[model samples]
Target chain A: MNVAVTEPVAAAPVAERNDRELAREELTIARKYIGPFPIVMAAWGLGNLVCWLALWPLVMTGTLSLWIAFPLATLNVALCYLPSHEAQHSNYAKSGEPLRWLNELIGYVSTIPLVLPFKTARITHMDHHTYTNDPERDPDYGVKAANAWQAILTGIRRRQPGQPNAYGKLLREKAEAGDETAKRAMMEGLAQTLSFWAILTALAWSGYAIEAALLWWLPRHIGMSYISLFLSWFPHHPMNEQGRYRNTRHFHYWFGNIVSFGMEHHIIHHLHPGIPLNRNAAAYRELRPILKKRGCRLDGV
Target chain B: MIGKIVQTIGPWGPVLFGIGFLAPLIAQSMEAMEIAAPFGLSFVQTGLLIGTGLGLAAKFRGRWI
Candidate 1:
């Protein structure tokens, strides 16, 4: 007589396990709209250039005074950060394969005005996304300061020697860790900085020095300051340091979204980086209910 | 043909297009200022400067209200 042996139930089949994983992944798919992205970016670039070209002649001729041209130029310069931001995310040109290089090239060219290298910006930005509001770890902690003024002050302080700036220190650590990407970013940063100064020096030697200083250099600095204040500081100031949903602010103003390229819906971006810039608002609308349940803060201009 | 154009020009197509208009404008501005061309930048430098400037402006406009 054979003893009745109870066989243990076999584990879930491999295909079933794989199916479960696929289902979980599908739940995270974001709504993405990429049409008109390339056209809009191109138009913005062309418009700014046309504006500058038109203004330059008028300013030199005294038909349009510097007092007028200066502000307009500053506005234009400040706007340059948006395209570069998109480029950093590799979301500007969303056609197909072989377009990755186009994304990177746009990023680099667009950031030239800010004297920022694409790789450095990208690496630091990735860190910002990862660490978010952690004062000790986030590269963009200055942006999450208690107030806008505090954020600006923090940025200034961090740039000073001996300050515990997470971004700079993290770059150093990454280099020491033998991260090739970090190494390349550092080298690019140095090279870009030098290139910036070299261009300025060349301009000064060429006699268009004053023109370059006033028209080109000064506006970029002002634009950068504006970016730090509005883009980084205000949007992130009220965000909680913990949890993905609580860590970003969403603004529901159409005009604001238009100007900021849907940056106002930053919460959606933080939650889903794959969504293109043009589609952030749509994505936000889709996820609003879930985000609301999670206690995400919504604001407007 | 469309893919070829996009690939060849890449993301710089608009910028290059903008430069085409900007170069002449900068040259005119230099003439108005009576400053002789420096660094031999007659057309190309102006195009670059204006193109870069415009790109920066577009960036700001996109973000700031």
Candidate 2:
């Protein structure tokens, strides 16, 4: 991806006279680009998962070589998080809506390969949105680090038995305080984690150890690194700034937007969680000028 | 009884990780390199022995690196 960033130009002040008119215009433009239902994201989420599932059978049955399947599986795991992210925002359908079930279905089913619990992901992501760069409260704060390797290492360290994981720690504290939603998140997280290990252990013991490792375990670590790097760390790097636009930046990743799962337009998502993932780029294209005028951290486009 | 066994095992994670994850992977790579374990032991058998030993060490001692 083409990760690009230059020094952000200091924003020009909005004149009081034109501020209201400009703000109204910007709001109208943004709403127009909320765009259509994320059909593409839904397909990407489901199809990537199916393709990952198919890899296991193909490798086991000798239809495909492990050498090739490993990369494909890694790609699948990396692709796993975005659709569910859409679900986290309730971008597909709002609460009490009929298609909410579809939103929930995609949310729950899409992340199975990564073994992330839907409710857990949802609650923590909402926290992330609410407290994007808060060191103490943001569930993603653990991903903050000096560089990419540190970010990846931080992701790994958090999963180690005794190491502190921000989301897990937050959920545990909330559950202890008798928060019902936190309690559900804890249960789902535990079940998913156990299932992941149990299945991996069973497969390994049955002599598919290499397959299990490549298909799920290692891929999970790699995918988490990718997700954490692009989704959390990169967008919100030097993550101390507060407020709507300052907390996230628009930068082109060296690997390009696709590899980063279109997070290059992440600033837009933070500003309007309702904008579907596919529409962020187009929205950002239109909204960039307004963002610049407001002194958003639009370092790169 | 189950708790006793679980306690006795201390941490089963490293042990399982060693045998289930580390061992087989190492064995596969070793075999690919045309290397063989000493005493005519199969590569996987050697890996299991080593992985279990290390896993148990980490289990009791806490931490894997």
Candidate 3:
């Protein structure tokens, strides 16, 4: 099922509200937004098991070293976990406690195998969806530094600079100005990332140190970052067209489909997050005619 | 182009596939170690380990392609 669009209109801007007050609103909305939780959880659990079982033998064997295991491991990561992302947005099934449970389950397995907490991921991911590309508000919304050297220097800078990030500045203003929900979201995101790492450290302390590092931390934090950099950077390069269909290039094969989990239909996803991954093809088919009429076409895998 | 084609499918493909084929055998060896308890790692574990290792190494040779 798709992410249900119950109300497609904008709500009031969250400004000057207290945390408790905003949280109450968030809870009310979150309850409605959080759809099928159980099915998503089970599906993710089974998918994770299959991926681990399928590749673990290879890694356990001398035949596949850490290098080979890395890519094969990602075969499941992009495919298996992306659906969890969709589920987090309550797109997997219709709304209910069952949906919430499924979201929690799927979110937990997908990242925890890599040692991230479902609680934190869900919170940050919600921020990501709501704030999409809004540099002033979104956590994942990043900007290019003035130059390559500036960017490199910034990474080594070790502090949120006096010349703040656009998002950081906005968040600072919002917090100082008493935007409770925004402040709470920012705080929760910080807590979530911190908690995820804390859990990872604890897992390492527990006997499964190697597994914890390889399966949990390295892939989620390191490997996925590298993959995302390449995926995002290339697609949004200056040479790419401004038009939707021409903006991104699809690899156009089963491998692409398996890897992206229908994200290759990028434009459609932005237009309608409610469309399920399985239904991406049908959604594209239906929307293409209308979109093309408006001088926009969605590229397919 | 021809060289790229040959490098990929001719040599690289077989080597990767060979590794995939031998993965189960290696797993069997490692699992066998625990299974072969009490008698230091029984002949079964040693044989499986050595056999799988040698088989994979042989497969890596250019002639195997």
Q: Which candidate has the top score in TM-score?
A: 2
What ranges in model 2 sit over 4 Å off?
A1-23, B1-12, B24-34, B40-45, B56-65
Sorted by TM-score (best first), the order is: 2, 1, 3
- lDDT (tens digit, per residue) of candidate 1 on A1-301: 1222244323554244344342232234362343335546545654665676576678666798777887887777777666666777667564464666667666776656567777888888888888788777677765566765677676655443234545556777998899998887877776676566556656544545445556666787677667786777666766465567677788755456666545788787677665655577777776665566556777764
Chain A TM-score across all models, in listed order? 0.76, 0.91, 0.56
* Cα lDDT of model 2 by residue, B1-65, tens digit: 53365446535778877876677766766776788788989888988888888777876766665
| Candidate-wise lDDT, in order | 0.62, 0.81, 0.47
Error of 1 at A5 (Å): 42
| CA error at residue B38 for candidate 3, angstroms | 38
C-alpha root-mean-square deviation, each candidate:
14.1, 6.2, 16.3
Q: List the candidate 1 regions with Cα displacement exceeding 4 Å.
A: A1-29, A34-38, A42-65, A92-96, A156-166, A252-255, A259-261, B1-65
- The alpha-carbon root-mean-square deviation between model 1 and the true structure, to one decimal in Å, is 14.1
Q: Over the stretch A94-212, how does candidate 2's per-residue lDDT look in tens digits?
A: 89988899899999999998899999999899998899898888888888888878888877777664455678778878888989999888778877877787788778767787788
Docking class of 3: incorrect
